[model samples]
Target: MKVAVDTEKCCGAGTCVMLAPDVFDQGEDDGIVVLLEEHPGEELHTTVREAANVCPAGAISLS
Candidate 1:
């Protein structure tokens, strides 16, 4: 799966990072959502989806 984030839409709630630290993180300076893995393996598919679902700002997207 491919993961992407819209930093402009991110509120830095950290929900994505908490759900899947391997694929997401926060920008050190702005606390914005950072996409760590654009394309992750099947092992992280579930977590990535959950992160997208839980993102309050709707910044996470999977395709």
Candidate 2:
């Protein structure tokens, strides 16, 4: 699956990073969601989806 994050909409909640650190991270200054890996493996799909679901700002997306 392909993962994407809208940094502009992120609120520095860090939920995505907390749920899937391997594929998501927080910016050093703003703590906004950062995409660490765009195309993650199948094993990580669940975690990535969960991250998107829990994101308070709805910044995470999967395609």
Candidate 3:
């Protein structure tokens, strides 16, 4: 699976980081969503999807 995060659309919510730390993170300075892995392994797919779904800003995209 592929993951993408729109920094401009992020609201500094850490939900994504909580749900999928292996695939997502928060910027230290502004707390925006940061993409840790553009392509995560299969074992991480479920959490990644959950993070994307629960993102308050709808900044997470999957392909």
Error of 1 at 51 (Å): 0.2
Full candidate order by TM-score, most accurate first: 3, 1, 2
In candidate 3, what are the lDDT values of residues 7-45, reduced to their tens digit? 999999899998888888888999998887999999999
Instruction: Show where candidate 1 strays beyond 4 Å.
Output: none
**lDDT tens digits, residue span 1-63, model 2:** 888888889999887778888998888987877788999989999988998898888888889
The estimated TM-scores of all candidates read 0.95, 0.94, 0.96
RMSD of each candidate? Answer: 0.6, 0.7, 0.6
Model 1 C-alpha lDDT per residue in residues 1-63, reported as the tens digit of each score: 878899899998999888899899998999998888899889989888999999999998888
Per-candidate clashes come to 0, 0, 0
Q: Total clashes, candidate 3?
A: 0
TM-score of 3: 0.96
Error of 2 at 29 (Å): 1.1
**RMSD to native, candidate 3:** 0.6
Off by over 4 Å in 2: none
